[model samples]
Target: MLFTSSSSEKEILSIISKQLLLGSTDARHPFRFVNLCTLDGNQPDSRYVVLREFKEDLALFFYTDSRSEKVAQINKNPNAALLFYHPIERCQVKIGGKAQIITNTELIKEHWNNVQTEAKKGYQSVLAPKTAVSQPEEGWVQELKYQSKNFSIIKVRAKQIECLQLDDEGHLRIGFNKKQEVWQSTWLVP
Candidate 1:
């Protein structure tokens, strides 16, 4: 287990922050790809999204096409959740937060500039995600585009974070809730 039963809350929080920061830049990190959950009316919608950025303030950011169904869902309801797991470490981190589509043109442009040439195709698709297509290729852009108007950033401001460490001895579960800009930690039943 990454954390033991006697591990302090600060230690766990530090580990989580470091792992998330590393995930944003390390392609091979297990946390690089996370399951993002959003609400589609009464149903839950989920998909894998790359961890684009992890801010010092504990905000998580992901890139997506502005026209995608997830974008619509987020617009209707900002509440969302993210799950990250490290199989080798037997650690799972769950985050509950509010999501907001970043609309500032300058911020979007800055992030867009950082996207690799080949990776930009995801946002440049002629057809939006989840659109019905006869062939898989029909959803892709015929010509490579330098800039994509559909590129957008989804930022999740975490309200609560929970970490679970699995071990033969005993599983350790801890939770951190943000209240008035302060994070209060508590031990939870595993």
Candidate 2:
């Protein structure tokens, strides 16, 4: 079956808000994703990260070190892509946007202050992501604390979004593009 559904970028954006506010029933927020792509230094890089937060028509947040390569890559290339999926629901969401490193000290504190010790453990890694080094080992973290000062948040102001509905009947694609501060979506053959 070719399932067809479309919405204004803002409306579909609302769909995400509905999901995020629906308590733990929403698995989209926790899925590990591999979609932030960077073109820097002659080579493109990407990585998997937890989906942190989103504001309508504005920015999406994910945490990383100010010193990480991804951070540096974003500096070189602000364009990036985001992929979201649910195994049981069989739904996928794509977000394409220009990224800006969050620089507001207050915003950093607000986001960091909410980070629990467990979540903060991620920032304590000794090995920088995508770095090649000696034998890989774990448990070198000195401590687990909500230290947000050293971390930088990546904010993507989405310019386009492509939602793919994957099921038995091949797949269905929904495309949304942002123009003049408005979102437009169309059905495309998948």
Please report, in order, the local distance difference test score of every candidate based on alpha carbons: 0.92, 0.68
Best by TM-score: 1
Each model's TM-score? 0.97, 0.78
- Predicted structure 1: lDDT: 0.92
Candidate 1 per-residue lDDT over residues 1-190, each given as its tens digit? 6688778898888889889999999999999999999999989999999999999789999999999989999999999999999999999999999999999999999999999988887877777788899988788754465675989999999999999999988888999999999999999999
Residues forming the 10-long window of minimal summed lDDT in candidate 1: 139-148
**Model 1, runs deviating above 4 Å:** none
